[model samples]
Target: MEGQATLNRRNFIRLSALTGGGLVLGFNYFLSSCTTEQGSGQAFDLNAFVRIDTNGKVTIMSPNPEIGQGVKTSLPMLVAEELDVDWKNVQVEQAGLDTEKYSRQVAGGSGSVRESWESFRQVGATARQMLINAAAAAWAVSPGECTTENGMVVHKTNGKKMSYGKLVESASTLEVPKDVKVKSEGSFRLIGQRIPNIDNHAIVTGQYKYGIDTKREGMLYATIIRPPAFGMTLESFDDSEAKKSAGVSQVLRIENKIAVLGRSTWEVMQAAKKIKAQWKDDGTLESSADMTQKLHELLAKAPKDKPRRKDGNIAQAFASAAKVVELDFDAPFLAHNTMEPMNFFAHVKADGAELHGPIQLPERARKRIAELLKLPEEKISVMMTRMGGGFGRRLMTDFVEEAALVSREAGNIPVNVIWSREDDMTGGFYRPMYSYKYKAAIDKDNKLIAWHHHSAGVGGSASPDSFPAGAVAHYQVDTHSYETPVSTAPWRGPTHNYIAFSEQSFMDEIAHQTGKDPVALRLELLEQAKNNPAGKVNYEPDRFAAVIRKAAEISGWGKPKAANIFQGFAAHFSFASYVAQVAEVEKQADGKVKLKKMYCVVDCGTVVNPSGAETQVEGSIIDGIGHAMYAELTLTKGKPDQTNFHAYRMIRMSEAPEVEIHFIDSKAAPTGLGEPALPPAGAALANAVFAASGVRLKNQPFIKSGLFA
Candidate 1:
């Protein structure tokens, strides 16, 4: 439970000072930290920020690129928390490219909340503290008595109040205070309160600008025609007709593909349609069927366990079992499918390059652009725009590099290269598909004896990286990997996403056979984990049991419910947060699933923005259910099979279940809300479906199971 906690006020002040003008925002605490900047004593630079004039118009410098994860508002809330200001008065802006003003901005792993929580807090708190100090000096009273509220300091004795804007000049002159006091948990007024998303207005009104909306002076639009498969190379291109298309300016090949540039994105699309480019498939084809077989093989041939934690002999216990049952579960590959597709505006001049895009990691994008241009990182600038959505896809900077290359080829006249929906779907990079085989043993009394679980995943499809792998004992882990034509990277919940389905479903089977309550059955396993567990360093049994029991009670388990709906339950600990989900669903007479309701309970320590955290948890659970119910990617001859929305499906508003989230308000430091709630919802739904029907559905997309039953 203890590691390096989030940065504090002192650290934030130091980092802000180095970055020139510091940025401050309140992000929910959920960003995964496996790849966070993990060094000390290195001061950051702050040239990319601009705090508003003292008119109470605070323009926050946004560091992490947001693609609909609500960072535009959520992140700024953190700053407002320490600044002692109301959330309404704050105005926010996207941070431009500058290492001096930011740290690593990679946005994957759902670490956005926890990763930037303290640093940004310090920025807001430091500035506000200084402002209060300035106000105190002006009032000639101790700051202790002059409380700040909604950007104004009130000298209660004198009944005089002044806005933070009135003290900016004086506050800016103050030296950075070391270790400024942060608000205690009980004192938080805005942090744990419900506030609408900061960008909600812009988004609803269409005023919000994403990377796809970016335009520069004399900017040209580009759509690239890369090889159909990953690792495939471009062999040749005949652009005679493409150059003749209306508004087409140039056709150039860069980074193993031909880019068609034109005066408009539409023109570029038209021109690209005309280009007849020949590609030689350098990568081998990997159909879903082929990959599925390879996945099973890998699961069966797993190697020695990594064993981050251990408890007892899993093999010995299973060998002595009075009953044993085995099952396999599969999770398919997925896409980020951000509303704003991959696009970046880059103006590569003889001296430098200016890049603008919706990206997760600005540092990575900057570095990648620098390398491609053969220029120094300092010479390349990245301007992050508000993302339409992230979902861990925009974290890759390859799109940025592609934009830079196209801009360079266009003679550095600011050019924005955009991917069509088809391009995004077939281009490359996907959530790795995964498979899990679970076997459980029980005694004559129907008490569980032992369990053996393993995975078959390629690339990034493994358990949540934060879950200590060596924590389990009597565990065996082996991976079977074959080269895939598609690229792979992290998705929401990463590996924990799939493992939850398999493990929770298998656990449900145990409860069903023994006539024990499902939630109680899991508590029993947590009890075993408490005594002689499978891993040495797995989760604390008490905490795991706490979430399960809490979820059951909060969900009104064993209580009466509406007609035609059955409840299923599951619990998981991920992203440093514990979550339990109970899904209420109905199988319609026509065979379509109606997800009537979902009840989610989460314990993420101190609740930061209760509203924001709840929203995140709700959305994540929906995404998990959506993926399990319907979402898949396939390939043929190394070409992506699904080209757009028609083939690749997502949970629509019509199909989205009604979600109610309950947060366990713990005094412990807050964890993340982005991904922990996602893992169990799928498994919970699966268990619920089985409860309704006599048949046990073992596959994902229960619809896939419907065919057999």
Candidate 2:
């Protein structure tokens, strides 16, 4: 199955003449096993991701979904950089779902850039070499004698030049090189440069089309009424009044939800409210409080444990310690409230099906929709539109599946299923609530001697081998999980987001208890891991220390500050990247804690598109701080208490702090930047709050418990 999903180019390039006597170049990759050509009567199979026209215009297809991550611009930049084409002459188009031609066409886990860097650069380098080969032949010179610059190949000796368009026809006849040399890091012109997003004008001018802005001819709108709580069954419904409502077209049922279709979205939403549905749910539903209590009970009972890592005798180390410190931490469930609520458009027919929306996992959606419709994968087409935000929520295909099911039941008519803000907020699939217990011991010499952590949560504990695990001489990690009906999935950095808070905060507590600087303590642990490691350390200690040192230097970690201001520090490694943060917090006279600024250091190997990297870092910090300070979801009887933005507060502009991000200089293989910066922000802020107020916040949403008051 994995081999079938891989992308391979089977056919060579095909050249044709355009209507204006311009040359058109097409490269095709076979989608099926038989290697048959697609329509248009082309003899060779073609999957054109890059096309050069006679008019000196280059069009590149961005193979990943653009979920407000600047991938649409950054991915194409990789191709254009290697193609040696002028950025101005390039046009970027979003590719439809084509797993056969493009591998991993999704946009979650910050893998878009990391996964596509090599293949995309290779694509451009191969094309550039071909164009240079054509120019070298025309100039009666060796390929090495010719060089490319700004979309033109020039012979340095004679200064003879030819545009890429002029060589397309000749290049098409040549064989695709199996191995071409891509430019080295030092030779990169566009890769590291700060290029403006290609869609900036369209976005600022209100011309960009998001999922909500998509429209089709004769398309109907729909709104689904789901059960208020999980495990509820649709017992009965009365849609007679909804059918008579204004502009109401049809009232139907699909799966466990009832749908109201109308000519406009407003009409459908209004009609949905009028339809009365009777749901039958078991009375033994659990709430957030109940779940939290259950987790505590499980922890106290010492339920069956899955030991992740164990080193020396922890009991002996603790028993020989001078002092021991223990603490309990709890974090509530969270909701992914994307600005644009979950919406999708689908049209299913006996022959084929089409789906369009802001889906992060298009390939997965296509396969699932194919199975749901009882059709082959090739019979379905999925397209992605610009999304307001994804944050891992769009990774799920439930909304797309619902849209397809509704479209099929609605006489195969094109239908756009829209979820109101309330619907989206109250929907299932949330960040699972978690509870953690941490204990540490210090020896007579004030050296860390023992460490133990036990965690319990809905989806299981986050990565158990958290940082400092391999650094300690005697370390052990145990986890217990409780199965619940509540749907749970990855949220942003997934496990790292919550785990960083618990681990980093506890490390800070250890620092305070040992009379050591928090940043210095982490540095010492990293040094210990590098020099004399206890077990197999998964992270690079040098790289980890580099970021911590850099963040401390930039933030003036030990410098004295104003009376009301204090600093806190934290560092973490996630998504194959290392990040460290120092937060400056101010405790207002009224006891509210305010973040004044933050200094961040990131080491994601090599940087791609510095501007985009910075934007991602800044955004992740704000998102992290927002959730840590004010965002949380509570349940009452297995139903979300927060309905929309009014109740589910986000970080306001006034509350946002200045963030300074600096990346370590390296030419190593680049990793992801989207998620690594976030995990540390929560810990850094919490530690800073403690420094400012002389209080330890063991629970999330610090404001909920009047910690700020």
Candidate 3:
């Protein structure tokens, strides 16, 4: 099987005239040359990203999947902003997986906007310039004399005007320009504005096509009965009863799981429950308790450590300190718990394979499916559906691969494999449980002198460049990890999710022990990092301090607010963005923490869409706070104890607090918004809980530690 084809500017873009008197701009990033040959006869390329009909209707292909981060709307805004087109006249179409045409279609790391900002603008500007040049040639005037506005090319001196559709034929004949200017940020009409999601109407009117809503001719529904625990394999199964159930068509064993296929999803789900399966444990499995104990043991042994960063002499500084504060923090494994469970549709045949699903990485999935089916990469096609939620879980292609395997086993029939909530919740690839041991020293002058951090987990080391690293004179970071059979993958902010909680909470403790304000302490350290830095700092200290000050000012930090309300603040930088959050909490008579409000300040460079950026920050804060307050996945003999919402507690609407978000105003290139806001939220909420209850909750999932009780 051939690997993914390389993409370059020569083959990445093409322009051609449409048969119906319009223009088609083909942009190739993922598809191979063979795939392009399929549409050779047509005037327009088969994978044309932009199509303008004779009637002046414009269609723009959105390359990335819409995973609820509003890429479908935000990305197109970039194109339309540069294309000089009205949003109402433009329609967005979701593009299929094509690595050669769309180089970075995968939607994770909050990079959709950050990565697409320049390329998408170029795509739009290139198209617009073609139209303007075509209009200039027809008018026998210089292209400089023509200006475009709202899909119309106009002559400034005269009243001559031409619709983009009318100039398409001429534009198609002109050579593709080597250089085209994009609009200045100050002149952007759509990029910085608050644009409603293009699919809002379809979503509200129940016309959106999510993966679960996918259907095809002769498609069979399937549900697999997987192992109840990790390190366990299928030993035997009796599917006779399932085969006899109503609507049951076939019961097949694929790999280590049994698949029950039927004519309907409900029937297949019902029949799947009746199939009795037995599994044998590998005997190497351990419970979450054992894993936690193992981490503690590793910390105690002071195993051979990999030093991530070292500065000055930590031992000497600690010995000379007037006061030393040390603390240990632990966070348990967590499940993604996406609103929509894992699902995919696949049809495998002798000639080729087709897959449609909500996935984060389609190009990677296409390659994996090709390898699994023993077919060439070009022989497979992958389509993306609007995802309900990903949160990094969809980055894994296991579910999509399963659908393909099941379809092949079902004699090349189209199969849709839908995972129950239990299947998704109990599935592996969870956020690894992590433990952090932090020690800080202060001089007799009440100045922070030394900082040391040791982290151990199943996956790998936590981020070592966490804040205060470059603020202290003697700072050292060490990591120790142990391998486990259990799988782990990125969850939102990944390492920052847990590290922020531990590090920021420890900072709060330091502030209390030194009789200093928590927010002020962080600001002072940031100032130190800016002026007299200890070691190399990856983040911009100025921007870091800006967000901290902004958050404090906006949240009324150190000011008297409503009675009984306490505020806590925390900040962190990740993914090239700086985020700071202030959480407001109130303690009730029942000893439970009631989150009242949250204030967030973000410095993600340029803001593409103000409303969308605000929404993302707000959503991230809620997600982070909810997980910190009451979400954890513990393993019992390597089997997830939390299977459903009943066991895995989620923050309800009534418990959700009012979130106020503000973004730093700047013209710098935009960074990502999805993951950066999350890291600080957990720390801010944890700090707030401490302020309100006068009890420091060292462990995560505050509910698990009886912090509320």
Please report the candidate that would top TM-score against the real structure: 2
**What is candidate 3's local distance difference test score?**
0.85
Tens-place lDDT per residue, model 2, 607-670, is 8789989999999999999999899999888788999889998999988899999999989878
Q: With candidate 2 superimposed using the best TM-score fit, by how many Å does residue 615's alpha carbon deviate from the native?
A: 0.9
TM per candidate: 0.88, 0.96, 0.95
lDDT: worst 10-residue window of model 3: 1-10
Indicate whether candidate 1 or candidate 2 has the larger lDDT. 2
Quote model 1's TM-score.
0.88
Q: Report the Cα lDDT for residue 405, model 2.
A: 94
On a 0 to 100 scale, what is the lDDT of residue 44 in model 1? 35
lDDT of 3 by residue, 1-709 (tens): 1222333334444556566545555544233343443234355444436777666787888889889899888888888888898888999899897766566888898888887777778767777888888999999999999998988999999969999878876775677675567778789888888988888999999998899888999999999888888778898998888889999999999899999999998899899888888899888678989999999888876647557888888899999999999999988899998999999999999999999999999989999999999999999999999998999999999999999999999999999999999999997479988888999989999999999898889875778788988999999888888777788889999898889889999999999999999988998998899999988888889999999999999998998876668888899998889999999988777777778899999999989888888888888988998899899889889888999999999988887889998889999888988889888887898889889888887887887756552
Is candidate 1 or 3 superior in TM-score? 3
Candidate-wise lDDT, in order: 0.72, 0.85, 0.85
**Model 1 accuracy (lDDT, Cα):** 0.72
Q: Give per-residue CA lDDT, model 1, range 1-709, as digits (tens).
A: 1222343333333222224343232221221222223135443332334354445666666667676566666777777787777666767676665554456565666666667766666556656677778788888888877778887888878878998666765664456565656677788877778778777887799897778888877988889998877657888888999888899999998868888988998988988887787877664756787788888877777445564223357678687878887888777778778777888888999989888878877888887877878998888877778777777778787788888888877787888889998888888578887777776667788877555666667564444222222333344443444566578777777778777777788878978878899987777666666775444444666776787788888778999876666889888888777888898878677654567889888888777677777778888988998888888887766678888999888888887888888887687766777788998888888888887775666776666665212
